[model samples]
Target: MDALVGFTGPPSETLLRSMIATLMHRGKAPGEVFLQSNHASLARLQLSDDHAVGLRLDRRGLIDGDVTLLVCGFLTRDGTESPGGSVALSGLIAEYRARGVAALARLQGAAIVAIADETAGALHVARIGAGVRTVFYGRYTDPSAATSRWLVASEPKAITSAPAFQAAIRPAAIAQYLAFSFVPGSGTMLQDVFELPAGHAVTLSADGSSNLTNLFPFEDGEWDGRGDGDDHSHWVAESRRVIADAVARRLPVGEPVGIFLSGGLDSSIVAAEVARQHNHRVLTYAIHFGKHYPNELQFARSVADRLGTEHHEVMVNPRQFAPRLRQMIWHLDDPIGDPITQPNFELARRVSQDVRYVFNGEGGDPLFGGPKNLPMMMQHWYGVPREPGFREKAYLASYRRAYEEWSRVLHPRIRDQIDPERDLESILAPFFQQTSVRSFLNKLMAINIRLKGAHLILPKVERMLAASGLTPLAPLFDEELIRLSFQMPPRMKLRSGDEKWVLKRAYEDDLPREVIERPKSGMRVPVHFWFRGEMRRLAKKTLASRHVREAELFDPDRIRQLLRYDIEEGAGRYGMRLWMLMTFELWRRVVVDRDRTGVSGGR
Candidate 1:
């Protein structure tokens, strides 16, 4: 399951066999599963009987010629056939073959998909837009577009592992990772290799000509003329139906499941639905970062008590954070700056003990517009002047402060890439110019869908699969759920500074209003306080290490200055900067520097 099939050109029969051997875990099929092209570089997967239908090009309406394409990932929006994925993909492929041109459509599931058309002498590779499945492609010779060699893979580590290419760091992405605590867009921690953007696809012609295309076009669909009818309950009832259906489908019978209950609105909604439908008590897990971070035990216990389910909570310590920090860096494949990764990794480690399946509230932000961005969004939407309105001005002021703070801490090379003047253009410049209010909201959705959502859910899921063979079920990440959020009016999303206002109303009967109305408190890790206290020495030692200072990518002097200031001032601003540097150093040591001895803890 860890191994992914991708190469530069068409492979020999022996090479095809070797690729199949790498996937030794997949069981034997009734018919042939793996298919490769002698003329074109292509491979096809036959994971199930339905997948067999997708593997058969003859049955497919496309030219009925020999084209070996590996269709990875699920496409569920087309219909409801359990894994309605292969059906949607096959239909699109047949449509393209018949038209002999580009075929663009919205695919609901997370996948790293590649298709080769031998007859047309072209190949197409893509990651599902809002990229649930990881896809990476890079160049061997030059970083230029023409000299690039493309490889769409599921794991960043797999692409990094290619012996032919030296995995170098992208400093700009590293800076962004520090600021947002997650990499934005298609860029990853590794140089040149990019995660294909959500709602976008890249096509490589058989003649070696390449073009990247955006599949989902943003349209400002609205109902301004029509009144809301003031029926909030309708929105609530419909959301319940959609969420309940989505969860029920993902859970396989006779299997013990786990829910990452944060006692927040989103997870509470999921827990409520699970209790209503599922026969067994869904094993619920929570994370605590000592007393410094907000403790959700009391809130989570209330939800657990109401649902009559078993719950588990793991209190993480500094020692656990240090080791698991290195472990997550390895599994995450990309460098994400978020400290929440520590709590998530710890949660997965503990959850693996009780169950093999876990559900988390990843898509909640994008779906319901969680409290993080609500204050600013509400002010602007209601036509409040940016400088005069209290909420609007306060929000803009905070953003400007964050930008200035980030600018000061960032390395010059990274600072050069981002324009501070453009950065301060009222914060809504990017949203207004390119995307509609709805479309801009989708950008936030797209960000979480690609970065924060992927960072929080996928890495833990990957470790669970690698260690205990657990499968994570994220219903919020479901295609139907995303589409629902997109379709819902923005007014319902953040009314009166309440984040996830629509979600709360929808689950009102199922969840206590107190639980829904309470300020949002997801899993929190006290990395800032930790860096200033018990782990202070560890932080200093790691930043000052020879390996870190000598890493070819970063500026040694700049690194030293930032570390010195943070240690002396005890400001958490430098803690973020240090975490980004430390994660990169750890990644370089574990993933890139294999033969070294002192590669354990950076300090």
Candidate 2:
């Protein structure tokens, strides 16, 4: 629930103080520091327990005699830290000693660790895993030294606002944003502000030299995820235990809590486990879109009634979209094209009034596989013109819009500027390479974990929940459960055309068989269908508005054509595409045009 920011320069007390003020725009700012020699500055936010934030660990720490570390996220330590006890960066160095940075592997939670060595005047930064918590670094300069300085922060605004890095939009990042509906890879919209991808680390020297490191490289080794034997029951039993423990640890100590029960297998399973472990009727919340959309209220309520839990439900409509769109994007710095984001936002807002922690089945699909995965795998294997990157493009193209369609979607000017295949490979290739000596299913899962989860899903949840003043705990995304998930053979993940086969089996008796066996159509938000009818005027006005034209980020004629087709012959078919365009326009208005009021309301 907290963010961290730091700079290494002839410390401008002004900049340090400004960063603290700007950081407050995201969360509470209770921490700030600057070395007397004007070498470093730091700021941190400690969120209250009411937000239901997980791993309530402090960020500013001194590593014994070696380094000072500013940690943005939490670390699932080997043992307790004196019951909410926090260790200084120096204390960690003293505790772990020579092991020092190597002990970071013991970290099971999300974190962006920015460590500065006092003895050596050197710095090291790393991200713990593939979670929403991220660090963006960019080089700025101190006029006095004529040397390069750097700014790092959990949010890009902290770094991008500085004179050194904030200039204009990065075209390549815009191209990727236009392509994937969000900025992917290391690049952000700001040309100089680069995100540090998960499982990677960077080292900086006082002399202005730096190098990047990959914490977990497949080349170093491979984990087959083999258990004691080929026994299916043994694997299922282990899956249950690991997932159960992950869920249990995430719940609040003695405060009210709830699970986002969509009655889908993942949330249902999480709810059932909470009931089993806590021996109480856990509070559950589910989003109920009105009729004409796919509603899982019956399934969700059935699970709730069967578990004997306090149940709460909230409804959403297309009318709420206009006001919340910018606020949602503001919450999510990088706009996720998914329409369900707003619904989750409202769900978090409403549920926060009743519970501090809200657990959801967010990572289940990426780990255990999901329905949409099978077709992508098929396309990857069966795609024609199978060049070096075609399979990767076909499999990982989240937009699912054909490359041939790009010319018509984006203008020839914008479309020609981007090399779709090249962009796809740039983002997908690195993770795909890690699949060496692994199953194809595992390969896809790993790619999704590194790409989709890290970029789209996890960040969306993290920001929206924070904006709603609630913490999101995805047990399925728990560090150990994710690692354990990889160990299971692909067959267990997607077996005989059944997605999450092993997970379904693990929860068969505990959850209703109908719920477990039902074909998974994950939380369908009827936005596409509504856009064709109820939301059409709003969609058209937003997509074809003058503000969008002023931005000139897209082609007007192409947008008109798409809108015409979607409104006429296409109907709800291109619903996802329409939503993406609308989302980008809204984001452009807010982030580029400085439309703060567009993002006014939030927790």
Candidate 3:
């Protein structure tokens, strides 16, 4: 992953170098700086060849006169033209010079772009469609110069590198993380430091004023006019065509590609397409806990054998990677409580040795339907006691994270600062209240794609893979595929009870019968067993430490109850809550506490 980091003020070579040091793990190349009269920008070169996907060197210039353009990820044209081909970086800069922020609408794919306009006295940073790439920005007054400055980076650690930037924990984001297991919307766990949302851009002027704009709006009714009338085959054919084109656009030329096959529908579909299209050898990787635990290797092996792919399997356990926990969380920049984060990071470490680009079936669940929505749909139709804010409550509870226990787990001082309505529910209110999307199911889909997909799923994957110096390709989350999903009738996605029906129908013949028909039991990380067995000692020591107690975040009694599994209501489900507490506590030490020693390997 290539990155750009700088501020909107007089050139400070020292500050630029400090920010660059924070992101050196992203790339080993020397950092390049472009200094101007009003602003300065620094870009780190990519380790892999940009021309692997037809991206020429001239098109991706770091500086262009009064305007400096810096891109973090690759951009591709819509399938109406070349499938995986990239739009020239030079062309994007030219468009920005002419049309300003409006030119962003023409850009597609998973990338983030930052433009510094010395002539206009303004700097702009935008995240392209579906947010596969992330850009975080914050505005603070430079204490030395007494002038306003905006610090931006690909990861939060870069912004925190500046000595003048004071980093503090944001309590409201803590509440949100407990509910969704990841921070939702533009706000991050760091106070005043915000993440740019998907299809959004932020502009900063010389005087420190800022403006945020949504370049690509996610409204529904726009797709109502499209789609063939009730003809199942039409949707099947169209879905197959659109998905195939997406996969084609992401395949790197003349290099072996890797697929993270879970034997699930999403990864299987991606593997099948990659195997069918790539002329070079296709490699597939899968993980299992051990022989004692339930595994998906049989199904994944079936897919690999059918496609004749060179398959490799790896085993991950708590003891093997516990020492690297702090390093993994530091790489995440923000805390994501998913138990699979370690596995994803470890898998990428192995995959990077063989391939530069890896593809997975990430968007299938959020875009099309997956089994996670079934519980919410059931509660929507037949839950008891329809009270106010029932939908929001039901949706939050569906995550099965710490939503129900958030208040109990938090210390009173910390809990008092958070309001469920203003902080948590407000994030979902706009999507649910909007009448533009008619169907109830589509509303849930909108929430899933916008909140979970952008904030959690995509960012988690990008950070994990990027940490190991590998670029991730998610064709299912393509802009064209996203639009095509909305045009599809909701029933077409969740037919009767089967999820992702259209996807299955599209590639029924290409996959094995067992693979296609088997219900989606995702790669379930055994957190519960680990808490009682392998990770038990580590969890107990970390959660009960003096640092955790003095921070006044979690109640000591509640932590004891969770460790003891004494709570009757959530018995046998305390592992997830303990994991969330452990992740946040560890993240707080490295990020907010500024404990550099903890980042390498925690005790």
On TM-score, the candidate that comes out on top is: 3
Models 1 onward score TM values of: 0.80, 0.88, 0.95
Model 2, TM vs. native: 0.88
Q: Which candidate has the top score in lDDT?
A: 3
- Cα lDDT, all candidates: 0.57, 0.68, 0.82
Question: For every model in order, what is the number of clashing pairs?
Answer: 8, 10, 1
Give the per-residue lDDT of model 2 (tens digit) for 1-603. 677777775567666655555556444334443333345666666655322333545534543344566676666563444223343555555544566566665555666777676566756778776665767777776454566777777766666555444345665565666556667666777666777766777776777777777664422233465554457797799899988877766656666677889989988988888877664347898887787677989899989988888998889887865677777787676655777888988888787677656778888888888877887767656756556776566654545532335446665555667776566456777666663646667777776677777777877787777775666777787766777776667777888788998888888888877898799877887766777788788788888757556766667776776677634544444777777778777666666666677556321
Which residues of candidate 1, in runs, are more than 4 Å off? 1-3, 12-33, 39-64, 77-93, 99-106, 141-148, 206-209, 217-229, 291-293, 378-430, 435-468, 545-549, 552-572, 591-603
Instruction: Report the error of model 3 at residue 93, Å.
Output: 3.8
Give me the runs in candidate 2 sitting further than 4 Å from their true place: 25-38, 50-60, 63-66, 78-91, 95-100, 141-148, 163-167, 204-210, 217-229, 279-281, 379-385, 397-404, 433-435, 545-549, 566-572, 601-603
For each candidate, C-alpha RMSD in Å?
5.6, 3.6, 2.2
CA deviation > 4 Å runs, candidate 3: 29-37, 40-44, 54-58, 62-65, 79-81, 84-86, 220-222, 225-228, 383-385, 598-603
Supply candidate 3's per-residue lDDT for 207. 81
Tens digits of per-residue lDDT for model 3, 99-125: 989888777877777888888888888
Query: In candidate 2, which residue pairs clash?
Result: 51-471, 61-89, 62-88, 62-89, 62-90, 63-89, 63-90, 64-90, 64-91, 225-487
Sorted on lDDT, best first, the list reads: 3, 2, 1
The TM-score obtained by model 1 is: 0.80
